[model samples]
Target: MKDLFDYCEFGDLKLNSRIVRTGLWESEREKTGNLTPEIYNRYENIAASGVGLIITELYSLYPRDVFSKYSNTTNYARFVREARDLTDLVHVYDVPIFAQLGMVQYSKKTEQNIAIDDVSIEDIRKIQTDMIMAAQKFDYGGFDGIQIGLGNYYFLSRFINPNFNSRKDRYGGSTLNRLKIVLEIIKVIKETTNLHINCRLNAFDGTTNGMTLTETIEVAKILEKYGADSLQITRPRSPQFFTRENKEKNPLIEASEQIIKNVNIPVILGGGATTQNQINEILNTTDIDYISMQRPFVADPSFLVDWQLEGNGETKCKTCNNCYWKKTSTCFINRSAKWDVKSEIPKKS
Candidate 1:
């Protein structure tokens, strides 16, 4: 029987459990883009909480991008130094952490939100260079890996999607051509850094000519062949699209199962699970060994500790998605309460 708490290997990193804590907004950080005490405290709680792996909130590549305000930017001067401290804290508990790097839009000095088809060869090179540089910083800061955002509505996601990328250049037309940009990025990162490269990808975009499960599986195989250490399969609009009402038939489960069969790298079923039983069921019933949760962690960073102790625990997250809409790290429903790490419970502030 596969258990959620079983220690296992994800790529070269060993984890305490099958639960992967994936993050989004970092609204708790300082306005100056420095990691605050609150940020460190939250991470400490999560690192100690029994999560198998930790993928940090999005590290926006460009400061002026659309999601930059809601994410942690790599442009901060103290990023590497402060990130080193944060990684050290997580390492104390032997939890491997990955820095989630992504940008919603690509912008140069004058051009803002450049379309995928409009991006020049020069722009592609710049984007790749920026991503490589970010990976280098992450390695220097002691991250176990880096989660490249090829999922969701990020620029790279659109660039690789047929519906969005209409360029006649080498970056468009066929799946391989569209994927060449990401493949090139992955190759350089693999060669340059020791950090594991985990790509977050959409199982299907649900668009007319966009990425379907068939194409995504093909993409997964190519990534595995070229060198992605692991993959987290998500939808275009993930946690928001996955609510209690639609819990019975999560499309990601089937999509992930298919993708896993085609690739040798670790595959994580990202989002839509809320309880220990749910996670364990997915683990035993499917080939997916790892499960990634985001909003539940936002609700309570230490929820996994309770799940392990109780053995049948479910998350307190209402899935209200205030965190998603408001773009904050702290849960709206539990905003008034503070996490009491000592008690492993939420207390009224």
Candidate 2:
């Protein structure tokens, strides 16, 4: 019988392991969104290390709306081809990559912003078309799928908070309506490409009046019904992870349990995924199809290989979270150097 970690179909991608290298960005790209060899090598290395699926950091769907300081890849002509090359490299390692896509909104708190009100339906159409085109290109480049990203919402998470999207139109009002845009985008991409589609939705806002698990689960069920290959869920930080502490209680984990009970498609839970026991518990205890590991991979891309092949207890990583602060995506305690590779895939004799 095939096990949970065994080769399985996730959306369009056939994954060999249940471990997914989730998105963590540190502006690793050049000024343009094109990927440098170093960045390609960084991801390819993780693929070689046994990450079943790789979802790149949130990449913009539109060209000019780039905001926030963290460097990222863009779909502009300058780097689009080179960005495709990165996907090709991952394919070489027998690992599938998903080009995580998103569009950012300027913070009204700042000097000025892209008023959601002013965004011409024509502009939205062009933007949606671009996303569809990008997903097609990712398929041409050998990627398995694309994960839709919610642009910096803590920057605007308050708006999606159900408390703030105080509007009369379709984009706002109800949680289902605010999320219709994402579902519509997925529909467009699916119509454009035959590749797998993975949709990521913010699961919790970490506040009472904010989007609670109830509303998110309702939305997730709809994504599953709409042919989403896989669904990745995470808690959107309203302020920052530094300010929010749930150590005494793991509400995120509880929410994951609730979601898994409702949906049949593979569900990925992101945020503070540290330690073997926690991951095992999610898999062993719930119907969660897989795990989305971030900081751990940054700490050591080989963390997957070591944990599985060596049977080494407790990831050598302390989860100190320094790599997170640096925003470099490279861990302080366990850079790729800390890994001592011993196993080799054998040649057919």
Candidate 3:
């Protein structure tokens, strides 16, 4: 029998399987972005559930604003310890982990005072240094790789987009001009340490005023040209960018198609792709080397593990995007909401 358990490699690291638990923003981290007992407990259970790679939430490297997405925040030491704890916990179960690294260039002057709109070239270099230091620490600890965020409101993406990155400096003019910082950051990480690099690209803005597929593809090509090991090109997501209707379609599939066609390196996709049939069709038709599941994994961390066993089982998700918590929290259709279930707890519980 063929190994339905597919295997793939990125740069120097070999992932045990191609199924990835997309770096999900569980919002369970400490207000300061530190690892919480809840977080370690959550992922420890997830690791045991059998997902090969657990790419953690989008983690801010800014020691101060590590918990920016949350209104309340924690201090620097607490954040680092929390990060270490999650990775430590994952290692015990022997699952490879990657930290999604990003910087905030959103807003003119947010509380942290480190917005991309205000970051100078020198400031960009210093931030790159901070990223390197952080990655080195993760490497020393036991992380498998570092995933780079570059699209939409991300600092690197801000610099990449002409609309957001309106500046006269070398870091923000033409395509090559804006890419100086990103290229520098990638070079620093590879030259300084041996950690695997995976570029998470915003391959399409899906809007009239933002980055087009052309711009994103051009950028992905550049990242590849510079020795980036792999690319995970997803569509323009986030309530901050697209509409509900656009979010409904599987933008990950389209972006993955564009990325696979442009780059020779391994590519991955993660978006509205939720079913076994959907994933299988994508793999058969496109060049995507991997399928990443975020919300589906959140809804049921063991979905892939179960798929491996049952080979096309029912998806627990209702395909509703209510999990996106801009204000309050709710789901499209959860156990408690159902009339049949008297009370709500995890089905597995």
Candidate 4:
């Protein structure tokens, strides 16, 4: 019988295990969006820690956006060539890596701030072009896959959510029309590149008018129809962080199971899975192809190693969102050793 540690296939990409390290915001990018040594070391640690697949922190397709100071895009060829070193390093550990591409909103500090949902058709087209170009460059950089991040309330997610998108134009009004931007991106990538494309769909949002699971499920079907290699079912971030008492029973599981049953493509489920037993139960019972974790990995990069060896043990992560405040995504519980950058930078959350 196949276990979580066993090899599996996601479209053309091969994985050493079923545990996936979902994209976490690591504010460790260089000026030109090149992979910094710190970021490289992080990936190396994650790859060496026994996770099967790794999705890198979101990379900005349009670097000039206001929120893109940390993640930027410049000369694709040069950036890709330089980034090949990080890819080769992770590959050495037999872990497949995926590059996540997202668009950023302008910060209040920027003079000409623009909201993600307020973008015009031409701007949307430009974003699609940037995304396609980024995907091509990531393929050149030796990534096993590229993930279209329609989660975390990013540009793509804003468009996908009815609550955020109020436009009556082609990019809004209806769910399919709202999804036009991402669908176009997927089509272009499939037609133009060899890199396997994955999508992180925001299945639900906490707000009243936010996207619903049914609509997201429909989107997943269309994504599969349009040649997406895999679907990662995620949701918009909760306003409050998690704790041991309020861990919320894998909030994404029910919807993810629905998506897995509907889509032919593999579905990666990640929400509040902190224990090995929860992971095993999810994989064994549901049709969910894999389990992805973000905070747990932040709290312990060797989480998979510990889980596999011990069979079952609670993660040390308290879900205290403290590490999320740092640009480096440091765990506050173990902040001293892993992230010791002493700076006066104000915490985000």
Q: Which candidate is the best by TM-score?
A: 1
Two-way TM-score contest, 2 vs 3, winner: 2
lDDT score at residue 258, model 4, on the 0-100 scale: 85
> Which pairs of residues collide in model 2?
27-71, 33-74, 153-156, 153-157
Candidate 2 lowest-lDDT run of ten = 340-349
Error of 3 at 143 (Å): 1.1
> Predicted candidate 1: what Cα RMSD to the true structure?
3.2
TM per candidate comes to 0.96, 0.83, 0.79, 0.87
**Superposition error at 219 for model 2 (Å):** 0.7
Q: Residue-wise lDDT of candidate 3 within 256-288, one digit each (tens)?
A: 787778888877775555567666777777666
Query: Runs in model 4 with CA error above 4 Å?
Result: 64-67, 70-78, 106-118, 238-241, 337-349
For residues 118-229, could you state the per-residue lDDT of candidate 4 as single tens digits?
6767777777787787888888888888988787677778877888888878888887887887888888898888888888887688788887888888888888887888
* Candidate with maximal lDDT: 1
lDDT of 1 by residue, 1-349 (tens): 9998888998789998888999999998889999999999999999888888999999999888898889998787888999899999999988999999998998888888888988999999999999999999999999999999999999999999999999998999999999999999999998999999999999999899899899999999998999999999998898678777774678899999999899989999998888888888989998889999999988888887777666799998999888999999998887776774645632212
The lDDT of each candidate is 0.90, 0.65, 0.64, 0.74
Give a tens-digit lDDT track for model 2, residues 194-280. 678877667776555667788878877877887687777776651145222435555556787788788888787665556666666
Error of 1 at 169 (Å): 1.7
In candidate 2, how many Å is residue 305 off?
2.1
